[model samples]
Target: MRARRTPEPYLWLLFSGGGVVAALLLPVLVLIFGVLAPLGVIEPPPAARVRALLDPLLVRLALAAVVGLCLFHAAHRIRFTVEEMTRGGRLDVVLAPLCYGAALTGTVIAVLVLF
Candidate 1:
């Protein structure tokens, strides 16, 4: 009999990609936009400039992708961490759907907001 395909690998790929993107992009983003800008260590972009930056379809898509992947990474981490912490072998049955469902929902919201 042929073995049925499992989604675990695909999910892990997303988790890994998300982690990398979050690690690489998020800190710099926070540093520039959240910390330095607010503390006046760096001048923030003007509102019109920000709007201009977001005017490109590619920029919006990239932003949406980053948000979506990060959400997926978070979901995967939360699911496995909770499962491990509880030492409950059966938790995967309940956790996977909830975690991934939330990620999917967030991705949808990001797309809608971006577009």
Candidate 2:
């Protein structure tokens, strides 16, 4: 008799946990920092400076982080969707590249805005 092995469900659980955390944190962080901070609603000791405090490098870095995480998360979700809707597994091969490509496109746009 051969021994049976069950894959760990915790991997998916962790991924889901991290994804949800990022999804929630990203938008809230943006709204607070980008909108509220600019509007002068929430003030810290330094008194949340407006756009005057931002630099091009910081903006581009923020854009890249948001874009990269969103693109990766979206790609995984889309892959799962395709898998559920179809009976074949061929689509899995292209999911990663497609997602990365979208991320790269966003990064390029961000870079362009920075310059």
Candidate 3:
């Protein structure tokens, strides 16, 4: 099955949305978790406090959306990059599913874990 043809538009939409979401969220996430939290600029909260922050349904849903979209973005980029490097569009069949399926799987996992 040609995964690209059936879902071309939707995939592109998701790719773009994911890029935007990742661009906006990733740096902040890194700054908080990777830099400030480690450097003691912002204290890392206790596990209970983290749990409390994630206790809300709305927050969980938003985080799931962000994770899903970012996964989609990465899948799109990797799929195309592979195809381009091979100098043929022939791999789109395998690449689309392999990439997007992984993204979908990750999204499902995020939803499961978050909710």
Candidate 4:
């Protein structure tokens, strides 16, 4: 028996969407536990150790990578959405470079912020 291979475009869509959902939700969850609960107004959740997240160098690299990849992922997803809505003409030409350019800019900003 042979396994089926999914198309690359669909796979990228799924991965990008999932990553966005996770990234968005995580901050909310963190705020709920880290700040809200600590104020004693909301029910408190158990604390989890985040020692690794506290390292400045590691944090900067991680933030930079996250920002860059996320922007690229977002660009692809948004471009597709725009394509569906507008339906044609030079979309790829305009969007592809913009996406890459934004990602590169984010990477440079991250490097500056980190350093």
Q: Pick the candidate with the highest TM-score.
A: 1
The Cα error of candidate 4 at residue 5, in Å, is 18
lDDT of 2 by residue, 19-38 (tens): 87577777887788788877
lDDT of 4 at 38: 89
Using TM-score as the measure, name the better of candidate 1 and candidate 3: 1
Task: Return the clash pairs for model 2, or none.
Answer: none
lDDT of 3 at 47: 89
lDDT of 3 by residue, 47-94 (tens): 899899899999999999999999999999999998999896998888
Backbone-clash count (model 4): 0
Model 2 spans with C-alpha error above 4 angstroms: 1-21, 29-53
Better of 3 and 4 by lDDT: 3
Task: Give per-residue CA lDDT, model 1, range 17-115, as digits (tens).
Answer: 999999999999999999999999988899999999999999999999999999999999999999999997699988999999999999999999888
Lowest lDDT 10-residue stretch of candidate 1: 87-96
* Candidate 4 stretches greater than 4 Å from native: 1-26, 29-55
- Winner by TM-score between candidate 4 and candidate 2: 4
How many clashing pairs per prediction, in order?
0, 0, 0, 0
What lDDT is obtained when candidate 1 is compared to the true structure?
0.95
Candidate 3 achieves a global lDDT of 0.93
Q: Report the Cα RMSD per candidate.
A: 2.1, 7.2, 3.1, 7.7
Pick by lDDT: which candidate is best? 1
Question: Clashing residue pairs in candidate 4, if any?
Answer: none
